[model samples]
Target: MRVVKRINALVLTGLALWLIGTSIAGAAEVNVYSARHYPSDQAIYDQFSKDTGIKVNVVEGDVNGLSQRLQREGTASPADLFITVDAANLQRVKAKDLTQPIESATVNEVVPANLRDADNHWTTISLRARVIAYAIAKVKPDEIKAYEDLADAKWKGKVLARTSNHPYNVGLIASLIAANGPEKTEDWAKAVTGNMARKPQGGDVDQLAALAVGEGAVALTNTYYYARLKGSDKAEDRAIADKVGLIFPNQDGRGVHVNVSGVALTKGSPNKANAIKFIDYLLSPTAQEAMATKGTSEFPVRAGVPQPAGLPALSTLKVDPLPLTKLGELQADAVKLADRAGWR
Candidate 1:
């Protein structure tokens, strides 16, 4: 009876050890909950795995949805990192207390000060500029000199945009607030409303398509969308793309409006080491090269990485000076102002 009891105890001990080992192995692999849905993202993750032998697990979803999920999961969340395209989403995460600050020397070196949170809570990896697009035959290149210029009476009944509530528009409005103050920005928003060719409806691409159909003469769109259309496999898309000329507005003053796809270390990351490694890897030249190449329509945020040919090199455009975090704070005010301005 004594011998049988000893064997049973030994077997139970071995089982517990195996379970602990499995948990540790699982923790070594980073779990990335990302809203970035680009196909090339997988390639970068795969490369990171190949180099470091650390596995990457991804959960792709909308930024708002993922932010809610992280809050619901709380301290028990297995997420090691949260990736998103907009600084506003990162601000949302920060507001939810769902992320922890990264203290990596590598991260500091790779990301520029202007492209990251002041406290290191999140870091931008790539950039996308919202530039003004005009139907080539309808408007001259000098017609729009800046974002503020779009509100001129000449542009009445010619502007196209997404909904006022969209984060993109809100961000732009926020920048306007930072530059020209609430009162002036509101006037600009009102002017934009007066100039709309129709009710503000549709994504950037839709606005571009409307331009092609003569519904509007100018539209606000991201650089990548235009680049994608120019390089699209569809001849129809290419045709519409060719009809519009991209204007890097504010070149003489504030520079173009820029947003980003960035990452934050999730609170209580089970794989902190691997998480930092992955973030650093994203900021590395290797990943930057891949993201800026033919597949992905973004510019690498890291300096010294050669931009892909035909891309608007970051150095060439005048970028707005307001930090992205400020954009988040101004967003609510922008929304309220938009409501008052009758921007639909």
Candidate 2:
């Protein structure tokens, strides 16, 4: 009887240990493959972990690199979610049929119709306006009022821009195609190329630096690039930020063209439920505000979120109402148009 009771106690202890191990194994965790390498994103993950007790594992890389990696991983990929910088990149992943449609009340409530994928494959969390930045000392504010006006003869040899091959530029051209017909867009591309102050080179930030040093009087760039500069701790960058003024062109007609940094769940995500939760966390009011203030100086996608101080109000600017998905579809055409126009 003593031997039997001892055996029973051992069995019970083993069972208790197994139960505890199972609970630990079942604890929720989500894996994220993201192109946005920002400290604010890490903050969001920390907050989400605190709020939900679910661990977030983030892996960062270039947008195209992450997308290709997802494709290579196929169904066995450990990635629960994917985030990227542009709508075009999001569309590329969607085109691969690697993303599953998400139905989350948080996403629908936070993101506007134009900023998300129609099939619910992805949703934009933040927006960056493509605007004209001018050297404050050289260009008069009233001289440049619209995107079309940039092609005017007087502006020729006075503009600096990134390569038309850049995704941001291509997205802006795509917006032109949506607003005007293809013929008009093609002409505009050719005319703008003629206005180049120098051969298109470098990123948007480089264009702003050029404007500061008088390399060019005006530049086509996104708003956040200057915002980033202004927010930088480096004094030289801040000085450059001081020299340029942002102009939301086409405000009178079709407001400014905006692009987004967005996210989606892989179609074969092993943890679909956890992926949805992660996306919802990103759209939460706390997350939205965090993005505006801490992540990128970008405007939040969520309605009613306060605009970051010193930035133009989203409501006041007339945003082109083109669906973001169309931007991806027109990307190839926009690139071809740039090539044909010799906008290197």
Candidate 3:
């Protein structure tokens, strides 16, 4: 009877050891649900893993789809971090209670306060300016100096942009509302809608292409799109880049409206410690430099990183200081204003 009891105890001990081993292995990796599909992102992840010996398992999808998956998984979700572009999407995830505040002194010290969430629920890792793209042959560089300039009578039927509901447009209008009162912004939106070269259609590149072919005088697009075209292997893309000139809008006022590619800690973070370490690693100089010069072509959130060739240094550009958190808060209002203004 004593022998039998000893054997049972040994079996239970082995089972406990196996469970402990499984947990340790799992804790050595982080599960990332990332909406950023850039091929350069994988290279960054690989570098992180090489440096820290912690595996980065990424599940790539669009923001809305990934957000839905998080909701469906609930607390049982294994996602350690959620990485996506646009503060508005981060705000949506926070509103759904899918994210928790990121508690890392390294992250706080590295990223600017305006570029991070007010409540620490998210932080931007890279930035891209929403600038005016114009045809040098059509619009003089000084003609459209600010976003407000687009609504002027002279620009009527000459502005090209994507649909108003796009997150990029939403973030842009939200920044406008933050700068100007809602009433004035709405009026501006209405006038800008009337100024559209055609009904809002296609992505930023398409808008730029339209401007390139003389379909419009100017278009609103993120800066990186132009960089991508300039660096593209295809002759046609480089041709579009050659024909288009960019105006960093509002440099004399609140500065150009810039948006971010940001990240957040999932509320259901299974490997919280490892996740935090990974977040810290992303903000490091090596990672920042990699992101900037890699296929992404975005400015690093960290100061002093080198800009891509032919692009102005980040320090030279006057970026809007409005806390990006406001982008999320005012997103709904921005959407409503766009709808009322016929920016469909």
Q: List the residue pairs that clash in candidate 3.
A: none
> Which clashing pairs does model 2 show?
98-267, 255-318
Top lDDT prediction, candidate number:
3
Give the poorly placed runs of model 3, Cα more than 4 Å off. 1-27
Q: What lDDT does model 1 reach?
A: 0.88
lDDT of 3: 0.92
lDDT of each: 0.88, 0.89, 0.92
Report the error of model 1 at residue 2, Å: 21
For residues 308-340, write the lDDT of model 2, one tens digit per residue.
Answer: 656877877788888999999999999998898
Off by over 4 Å in 1: 1-27
Top TM-score model? 2
Regions more than 4 Å wrong, model 2: 1-4
Per-prediction TM-score, please?
Answer: 0.92, 0.95, 0.93
* Cα error of candidate 2 at position 89, Å: 0.7
lDDT for each residue of candidate 1 in 204-273, tens digit (9 for 90 to 100): 9998988987889999988888888888889998998889888988988888899899999988788898
Write down the RMSD of all candidates, one decimal each.
3.2, 1.5, 3.0
Candidate 3 TM-score, C-alpha based: 0.93
